[model samples]
Target: MKKILLSSLLLLVCHIHYAQVISIIGSTSPAGNWSTDIDMATTDNITYTLTNVNLTTATDPGTTGLKFRQDHDWAVNWGSANFPMGTAVQNGANIMTQAGTYDITFNRSNGTYTFIPAAQPRVGIWGPAVDSQNGFGGPDVDMTTTDGILYTLSGFYFSSGSAYFRVNDNSTLTYGSVSFPTGTAVEQGPSIQVAGGEWFVTFNRSTGAYSFTYPSIGILGDATSVGWLNDDIDLITTDGFEYTLNDLVLTDGEVKFRKDNLWTTNWGSLGFPQATGIQDGPNIPVTAGTYDVVFQKSTGHYLFTNTLSNPEYSVANVKIHPNPSNAIWNLKHDTTIDAVTLFDASGKIIGNYAPNTTEFQLDGSNLSNGVYFIKINSGRDFSVQKIIRN
Candidate 1:
């Protein structure tokens, strides 16, 4: 009987120590701004969980403070004196953390807790021999993220082959292979076979939403000569990321730039005629005239203006034709005087000419079939134009 009584007392003591109810409190809450307790859910007697707990810091959203307490009381709590990300503490200061979704676990038996950053939604592309720019056999091309959640990547050239999305750079953390419709969750199933094309892609990791946009970006609408036709005047990539649509004739009509020649994903600006810049905000209005438009994708800074007038924005009046020229090329301009210089693709000076006249012929039969730049210094105003010689 004495032995039985001793065992009963020991059991009571163990229950009191290991089975006490624990809760979480913090500045950004479910914790009532640290004034109240948010009880943690428990599955086993020794394990507790608080899933999807939102947290933030005191001064900055990226930093956070939090702690664990017992029975909605602060007299007994767990925190860290060192305040490490995953370090456990008892009767200590609040734990420091960054703003993110977390799955926090506390083990009563060991006085241990795990503060894990939840698996974030991310999407990347990995393929088998897609192209040289994105070669197959592993290292995937990651999309750029602005908000750390949604991501986008554009200007990808893919051959007829298969690819898939992954949560991370790791090939193991991948989604399903089948070509999911836009907004559908990409599962970790099979590789998606794609036809040969240049593409744009976007992904939302949170909802498994993914989409592949075709390379159908062009100038269209009644403002343009095409007027909603499939033959949209395509923009050429000048600096890879930035694009240029040259010599577009628009009547007095509304115009916009769009992708896939669709109403969706269109860009324009109500703030038109601003000498400062253009952006992808509202529909742009145009007066009748021919113009060259430049769009900087990374900055959304664009400009549409008279090609010849704005030397800063347009190609120079000096014209080089048969641009994809062969051995012989013609250079013509109304203004004359000063030096003309030719540069290779790498900006290396190839030839210098002191023509001192308006018209000149460039003998380039010796040049290769690639891109070049011609810098014309007409004594007063100078401009650089790209030349492609075949």
Candidate 2:
């Protein structure tokens, strides 16, 4: 019985020691000799904690802190020997780093601890131009070269040995385009990668024109045909090329076509006089069998040059009462009407009547919940009103 009691007492002591808590104390120095100490004490359920320390004296003594609670896998490893940096309590995954020497440290009581060494300085491509424009809300890098050439830096390194760098052509670099200067140096740290090497600094130039390519072309018509008729015909060059048209005038004789910003073509005569209203033009005459069609422009109030064959319906005076009607709808129009038609949403005629009186009331109560259009035709004029059936 005594032996069993002694064994139970030893087990209790081991359990108490297994649940230990650790605290870190550290100080920052401008001379670059910063140091930290970890202290451990017995606890009930507390596991581990993590904190981040900044070496650069930029803000708040250059020290930023991060903590992790209840961490089961807590271990420390040497991050860099030259920089004398150490990482603590990485739970999972292998530690990755760039070129340079590093040391590792690990400690655990009830659980196993593992230390993984990694390199330092994590070399990568850094863009000075992108960083500078970040504050101004501009493009990461601007291509000001007339040839439309752009350059970006690319390269990789493991920590900080001799860094390698190369220049990548983001835009086609050609002759006469602005290029990056050769032999540029870059710095990488924290989360940044700097470019290095002579070629990485310079940009390649291109010798191409600096204009945007537009696939569609536009054409304008003379003032007389300028109305609706102007939109009827599309213009194209004789060689089947597309050209934009502009600066049209309404003269007594014909409409002329111009190329680029100069070189006017012979007057393209129209069949009808400018005074006569505009109507849709006939198909273009075929000389070479086919031609590219350009965009149409407004010459006048109408879109074409030909006069409308049917007489237009005009509404003179119209009236509606109890406009915000809940059931019945009443409509009145001037002149004797020939026919009155009501149309639904699909443009289908729902009701028709032979015109007699000037006033008519539509029994909207029978209509479903929706909107309807009423068309009234009188001799040469017609009027339409929107009626709600709610």
Candidate 3:
């Protein structure tokens, strides 16, 4: 009877501890008032996450307060006057939160917490061309998108096979793939079949509009003539390497150089008149003028000479054969290379080199299957290219 009584008490104590749900409450909430709670989820008792929660001052302005409470009760709670991350204190000051959707993480063990700006929800591809049928074989190849709805993968060399998109990979949120690249992308929808050889791939998440365009690097965004459509004003080339778009007009807007008019392979972030375009950088800003634009495909050196409103965005495509090679990838440019840095999808540096040579080779076999970016520097010129491994 004593053993039975002890077991009962132990079960009761365990149940109470396990049932202690942590919640985010106080002035900011999707519920519009401090009267409600946004419960956080946890797989382990130590760390809790409240995902896709909107903490706004829009509805209740000036009340940008936030806190984490146990079981939606005030008795057990934590707060701190911190923007992103800090150690929590019981009955502490409200966190001054910015108005945005966030993935809030709290470590119950150490009272440490963070409000990380949520990554945009996105989708990616799995195919024979990318990861050797890596759907069941390996991780899907992630796509790039300025607008979260339209995902793109460019300059993808194919061996006459097909692919599918699995709406989630590294993001905290999950979604479904579009089959045809046109129409509404429904959850549990049939997998997409995209096929070709060396093509630019684009898939729309909201509307299942997908396309494969023969690769060509050109200017895109609202600042250009076409205004953000796929109909990019193609850059001209004489030697098939250095590209030029002479006598072009731009405006006081934003623009980026892209391949096949998609964000799949693009360059921006270098400043006006002349600058080295970073791969997948932010949109280049144009104050206003018409100009002569120059782009070195091998080096990513871009120059905009203005006579009218603004300068210009220009680009050229660098082809990859047998996708570089089996074990090593070579970067060959006309100018002297000072340094090289390779980054993974998470913006984490995986490889760094100081070759200082026009011709440089790096091992590709060591990289895991996924998307990677290689940045090269030559004098003031630089180039960033997306490298893929299956």
Top candidate (lDDT): 3
Q: Which stretches of candidate 2 lie over 4 Å from their true place?
A: 1-314
Give per-model TM-scores.
0.41, 0.24, 0.36
Q: What is the C-alpha RMSD of each candidate to the true structure, in Å?
A: 12.8, 30.0, 14.7
Please give the lDDT score for candidate 1.
0.66
User: Could you tell me the lDDT of residue 3 within candidate 2?
Assistant: 100
**TM-score winner between candidates 1 and 3:** 1
What does the lDDT read for residue 184 in candidate 2? 24
Model 3: C-alpha RMSD to truth?
Answer: 14.7
- In candidate 1, where is summed lDDT lowest over 10 consecutive residues? 271-280
Q: Which whole-number lDDT from 0 to 100 does residue 69 have in model 3?
A: 86
Model 2 per-residue lDDT tens digits across residues 1-390: 999999999999888766545433322211222243443333344334232222221122224221121322234421111123233343322222222222222233333222223322221132343333332132233322211233323221112112122123221211222212223233211222322211112233222222211112233333335432233233432221222233333333323332221222212323222111123333122221112222221111111122223324334466777665777767676666677777764445788988577777766676787766666666644445567766
The CA-based lDDT of model 3 is what?
0.68
Once fitted onto the true fold, the runs of candidate 3 whose alpha carbons sit more than 4 angstroms away are 1-85, 89-124, 131-139, 142-160, 166-303, 307-390
Task: Output the worst ten-in-a-row residue range by lDDT, candidate 3.
Answer: 310-319
Error of 3 at 79 (Å): 5.0
For candidate 2, the C-alpha RMSD (Å) to the true structure equals 30.0
Per-model lDDT:
0.66, 0.35, 0.68
